[model samples]
Target: MKIGEIAKAAGVSTSRIRFYEREGIIPAAERGANGYRNYPADLIALLRFIEQAQHLGFTLREISEVETGVGEHIVSCTDALAMLAKKRDTITALIAEAQDRKRRIEALMAELEANRPAPRAAG
Candidate 1:
């Protein structure tokens, strides 16, 4: 497949695909005789995996590490699990902080509501 075809199949823009290639997130495409990029069909699956990992809050660096490890056959299930656990803990902390801020805002709103001026009596 070509870059456009791969991008369409991966649900990403052509520029994004190119950027991923430049960033080493995915392997570079083979160049055809006409100088056009030719990507393997498997590239689409790899791109989708990258998209999913990003959605799951994995940074590019983290994704790169995993990709490199997988490519080298050095990454184990336990290593992946550890990375996930760290991410989960970070997200949990962020959620707690957000909830605390929400509670504070609600409290301020209640205070403002209580102190609001009453209606004036008719003359």
Candidate 2:
């Protein structure tokens, strides 16, 4: 399919797909005789996995490592789960910190709004 079709199917923009290709996150697309880019159907699944993993705090490099099996090997499910658990804990901590910061900002904004001077009466 064409780039537009792929972007529509993946629910992302054409620029993002192009960026992913340029970033080496995915393999280069095959070129047709007409000089058009032809991508594999399986690329959709890979793109979805990349997006979902990123939502869970995985970096592009980390996603690439897992997808390519290039990092330190995990010998068992336990080892895999241990790594996942660690990431989950880190995500939780970051969420808590973000919430605390949001509360502090809201409090400051409320105070500032409360101190705002009233508008003068119309002449």
Candidate 3:
């Protein structure tokens, strides 16, 4: 597939595809005799995975680690599981912090409402 075709199929921009190539998130494409870039069909799925991982709060460097590991046979299942567990713990902490902030805000709102001044009567 061509870059544009893969980008559209992956629901990302062609520029993003090029950037991914530059960033080593995706492998470089093969060039045809006519100088057009020919990408593998599997790149579409890879790009989508990148997008989904980003949505799930995974950094490019983190995503790259997993991608590189898969390609190199370096990261074992135990390693992958540990990485996921760490990320989950971070997210859980963030959720707890956000919930705490929400509770504080709600408490402040209630205090303000209770302490509101009485309305002035008309003359």
Which candidate tops TM-score? 1
Segments of candidate 3 deviating more than 4 angstroms: 8-13, 41-45, 67-76
lDDT, each prediction: 0.85, 0.76, 0.84
Compared with the true structure, what per-residue lDDT tens digits does model 1 show for residues 1-123? 999999999899999999999998888999999999999887776787678779999998888887333332334678768988999999999999999999999999999999999989999
TM-score-based ranking: 1, 3, 2
What's model 1's overall lDDT? 0.85
By TM-score, the better pick of 2 and 3 is 3
Better of 1 and 3 by lDDT: 1
TM-score per model over all chains: 0.76, 0.61, 0.74
Clashing pairs in 2: none
Tens digits of per-residue lDDT, candidate 3, 1-123, equal: 888888888899999998999998889999999998999876776787788879888899998888333342334678657877989999999999999999999999999999999999999
lDDT (Cα, 0-100) at 113 in candidate 3? 97
Q: Which ten residues in a row have the lowest lDDT in candidate 1?
A: 67-76
lDDT string for model 2 (39-119, tens) is 876676667766776787778887776633322331245755765788899989999999999999999999999999999
Better by TM-score, candidate 3 or 1: 1
